[model samples]
Target: MDPQSALPAQLVRLAQEESFSPQRVLDAVHAALAPRTGVRRAEVLAHERGRLVVVARAGEAGPVPGACATFTLRHGGAELGLLHLHGGDPSTVDRAVGAAAGHHLAVALRDVTTAREQAELHRVTDAVRRLFEEGVRAVSVEAAGRLLVAVAADVLGTERAAVMLVAPDTRVTHVLGVGLPEELEQRLAASLLGRLARDSPAWQRAALTGGPDVVDAGGGPPGRPGGGVHSHRLRSKLKLPLMSAEGLVGTAVCGDVTRSRTWTPADRVLARRLALQGAVVVDNARLRELEQAHLRQLEHRAFHDQLTGLPNRAALLGALGDALDPVTGDGGVALLLIDLDGFKRVNDTLGHHSGDVLLQQVAVRLRELLPAGATGARLGGDELAVALAGPAADLAADLARAVHARLGEPYVIEGRTVRTGASVGIARAPRDATDTTGLLRAADEAMYRAKRAGDGPRTAR
Candidate 1:
């Protein structure tokens, strides 16, 4: 190969090799030129720390006065180094050779920079994957949101990250954050998303569009901040919408507190993914709460009377059984079974609708007369039971009288006054019967006796 052409070839080889070191390439350049061109000596000199240094040198020259030629190499219009030929002044071919080498050097530097960036990106991607896995495993929405913000802040290399919950009422309920003081984070969220809760278009755009956006407080163009006041000292923001099948749930916000930051594509992608995960988490939480509420309603219906909102027959029986138990049962339980004497007469005189109103009034009176630690339940059809604890037999008798009096009070049914009389039969645990069924049977018998005698109250013997 021609001596001048070989220099370019050497540059190509160096550029193709991995770990392209400037010193190594310079050494190769010198070695290739050593055979011809009377170049007894050659060196690659480049500026380092504001001073030129011989990066690579080959061969030796005893003396060469005014015989050296320095060829300045440039890349991307920036001066990088000079190729020094020591044997004699260079011709056009030597200058061309140095220019080719400089071009390859520029390409090599660019390749190295690209490779480093790619490696860093892969690391960031791995972090995101780990975060995704963690988010998927979280059982609660709050927990999942916390994990997302923490992971997103780390992955995006941002100052702060937050998950803001946008309630259906268009209010910001909760702000979950990472790497920020609670007060500042709250203020920051309120400034950005609080506006969304009101009449701000930024939030609507993000939520309706269901994508990520970068907003600069300075109101400058993309990646540039010209001049303006950053109201919160927040120079830049990246926000994405939290969405579910229902609609937009909330938003995931990331802020740069120190400087004006231009969000990269990777940052936007991470925000979108975090928002998506957050939506799923928030939706699941809402669904779980709704399910729990429905279950509670079912439980209430199962144990309560639908008509009067009191404990029904089955529930009262269960409670009575519990009261009869030796352990975990109340001390000295008194059972009173009351039957309204004139309830049937009232039902016949007025309509069943009026009967229902009377029954409701009766329930209310029974409840109002019940003492502390006592329970009132509607057994069925104007027959109600009351269980009281820690009261002597005499006190139980007095309570039964109070119940009768309360029930006997005038009830306004369908815009007319109505009256009823109550017959009470009282039974005490261990005095009447220890078992639930026996106690209930004794109470029932006593109540019938009260009705037969046509008295106010009767106690079991």
Candidate 2:
């Protein structure tokens, strides 16, 4: 074979023969090139701290120092290994030929290194994605935070990770810890999370700036205007702010007990990514909780009077309907309707604020005098109804007299003395008409009669 052509031919053959292991490839190159280079044996030198150390050799024996020509093998800007051609006359392998061979072998040497790096990237990405999905599926803010630290510990290869959730007022609501040291974990879990957010410079900086922080001290991360704010129980930590479009929601702290665990570029990348995904999960869960609370409040307002905080006309009618249900045997329920006779005059005299105060006081009085199984409800302005469930006949008479006396009591409104009177009317189911509306009508007419006659209470006929 032609000498020039044989070199490239051997190069291709080497590629085919070796399975891309660094040590094995070096041995293969030595085998293929020894006879042609005249320097018939070789040693592979690893680049370490600006010096090359002979790590492997192949063929007749290792090369003699200063008796060989060296080719620096490099991949990109980084040096991989060196090829030292040994024995015979080194001039037989021209500089150009040796350099070419060195370049090709360098590419081969770094093949596994590059492949492993890419594989690590893929692995990190997959782990982060899996955790993100799991966090999104979490049922509550606390659950999502717990899942975050648990999975992050395993994926990021750490024993301590804490999630600090911040409230809108910039208070630390929770600090959830997983795999933390005993003392520090307990402090963060039970004591520290409730502290003001400003106490931790590392956390607040990351939160406000929406960036990352490295706290490399034992006393804890520094504060904005002061030295280390508090003991984070961390020798070194990476604090990643969990940001949302709404703002900084929290911070995720991944740390170790010693400064020996340096936070690498890849570690920072993975932690920041996990923090962002976790922020979304936590933010969504919190928003859902807020929305549900608001909906419950709306439902309450729907069925209740905002002014006096009693069941409104609609709720009262609904309850009365339930009481009148044949399945419940009429509930033997009786209705007592009371109308404050002087409410409109007070509204005209003292303004609506004082009027509202009077009505609230009236409701309090009526509620206190109510029978054991009674419900007190406000049927719009100045008209209130009470339902007493199967009370003794004497109890019914007592409730009416109590209503008339208690509701007639004077009230103090905005430092002014005021008095009001309630006209009471009583009606019973199946006796004073069978339906809810009819019972209400009977009670209304009787209440008007009592008001006109100065009677304390008039039962529906």
Candidate 3:
């Protein structure tokens, strides 16, 4: 059987194997051509730099004719190489067979290249996802950017990578990178950092087109003339927009040359993927921070009274319990229950609005008279409670005098002088009553006792 006759089957088998290495295809071609023309040996030569280079050879065939059968490997009108079979006559049949094999080889090579590229894309995607997930766990944007840059550098075979975020108000681009040069950082900050953030034509184009912009850094667009800075240092740079469902978030830039370098299509694709992952990580981190802040605010509001901005009844009780704990020793917790005497009469004489002002004034006095160790809460209309810790009798007398003196001073509300007095009842913990509720009741009873005793301003029991 002529080797030329077997060329088609051999080429088909090679294509079926899905191996498109240049050397492997050449080997198959050589095998098919060896025995077909009664030639002792055969060789397959590929066109390189306008001349044939022997890629694969077999048998003892002497130098074959240069013009036997020339087959060009082409796809979409681009010539990749030419196939030259040796150790055979330059026959019409040989040319036809070589042509068929060349066409199949070209198609196979294209498919293999595409598959390889797709597989690489999937790998990179998985890596970026993992990086972002790790960033989310750490709750640090810098850490996330570091991982992103590290991955990009590894993928693109470059030394440096950077992630820049546009500030919300100033629109300045802030570098969020693991290992970026100081010069690059400064330049980005002083020049393109903020000035070109939201308005840069290159950035806008990438964001709108959903593609990357490659610039031979320092080459295009003249910088300050006679300036000390050399633009040529930044040879190649790739700018990839970080986009999310909300729109463009920021950009990821990577380069090899400290001053400049050239960028490739593969590098752009990888940078864009990293940017996408980084945006998600950053967004999630910010949301978590916001949620935590909101939760703290809610907790604060829960334990505080809104009207007076003071600790409420619930909070007062908690504080009393802590103060009265046996572990706290005999520090002595004192409770004073205060009632506004003749407050309703004032509300009846003036309007409710004026009464509200009077009540606010009274709350202020109580807050001032109460010591730092003490807390006060409004126990509903015309009534309030103050808790403190000190020597029982002395604290009681001191607080009662303070409240009476402050209240008697009077308040000027809406340009009118208003007068009010408080009747106070004092009780001590573990001395007057055991628990918080009992202490409060004891204090209330003492207050009424003072009111009945006809004691005017400084009455306390």
Candidate 4:
């Protein structure tokens, strides 16, 4: 039970606990001193913020002399603090116990300080991860920026936070945040970040070099320009360059009222991690938007004919089925089939290109001539069809006549005027045939009947 022997063991135990507060260190020191010989009470007093503060006191006895041990927790070879003991008789063993306890206490306090720093680093890392995950839900750049600012404020222990993004071409900075002071926000939006976006050598250097940098209030580093450039009167600042594979994206700046807030190596590491995650989220959102747009275009193309930009065969069939189901419950459906009589002659005389133009022109005219309830389709080659209700044969005849007249007009195809006519066939549902297949067969037979009738239109009963 030698005090010196027990001292190292106690210090090791204290180090393992990972408690680094001043109060915890003092408590450990008092506990170590309590079991030593001739020691009634032990107290530790240290200078904190230029004032003597009692960090730890133990034992039910009175206070000891303040000058017993001499140590200051200041910089540059300064002693840590004082350890006072009240007891009966002074001996070599008693003095050894006090010295040993003091030594162990100092070591314990240093370990505690290191542990606190590590714990703070872990906390900030976790927070940044959460922020990045939450940012994934952001639908726009402004929302993402606001999330970044909120995360920064929580991690850095700042009263307010703001995020600024530099426009690529305009070189203008935009403020995106949730809780920002009015004065700082206005100044940053109007001058500070905007000026940096406009022309700050430091910002430009960091952006171009693709690295991180820091600056303090009152223009801590020289070489930066004045006026709007020096608008931010921050006590300290930390700037990180945002980058992607293509190039630098932008810069992330954090400021606070703490003097030149010296960044730890851990802080820099965490900041870089956050910036990379933010970049990924933004990139993913953009990719999703592009994919949605591409899918819409493909859907539109799938439902329409590429050449005529009208409903194609498949769409026409689907429309026919839908139209027949309701009208079939009553009388039946009606179909009109039209074949361009001399379209092949035009293709042979002009060319396939001119033929395609003539077909498109024919489609337009047919669409205009058809009734409101009629659906039209280009069924390969020069064949076209229109479908309507069963009781509309007279109306169908009127449409067929109009279509024949329209087809007879001269078509200016690729600067060459060509004339064409159409042979029409009409078939009525329930009267000609009941099912869709039979009705289409009847219409096709009637169409050839009209063509054989020598340029006159015909209808099948």
Best by lDDT: 2
RMSD to true structure for each model, in Å:
9.3, 7.5, 9.1, 9.6
Write model 2 residue lDDT over 25-54, tens digit each, in one string. Answer: 556566555566555667777653234567
Each model's lDDT comes to 0.72, 0.74, 0.65, 0.65
What residue runs in model 4 are displaced by over 4 Å at the alpha carbon? 1-20, 23-207, 212-242, 246-267, 282-304, 318-342, 359-379, 383-413, 416-461
Off by over 4 Å in 1: 1-200, 216-235, 256-264, 369-372, 389-398, 452-455
Q: Cα lDDT of model 2 overall?
A: 0.74
Give one digit per residue, the lDDT tens place, for model 1 in 157-240.
Answer: 778777767667657666678877767665655664543453545556665688887775455433312101133245777776
Per-residue CA lDDT of model 3 for 1-461, tens digit only, reads 67778778777776777455556765666566555554344444443323456655555556644444555678778765555555455463476776766776666555654666787688677768776667677444455556666676666665566766654432744565435567656655565555545565555666778766666655554323321122213356666676766667667765655544555455566666777776776666556756877887898788777666667778878878877888873588888778887789788988888888887788787777776777788777877778886554357668776775677677888988887778878888777787888888888888887667636432323
Give a tens-digit lDDT track for model 4, residues 299-342: 76876677776666676676667656754443456788889989
Q: How many collisions per candidate? A: 0, 0, 12, 1
Cα-lDDT of candidate 4:
0.65
Global CA lDDT computed for model 1: 0.72
lDDT of 3 at 28: 63
Deviation from native of the Cα of residue 122 in model 3, angstroms: 0.8
lDDT of 1 at 16: 71
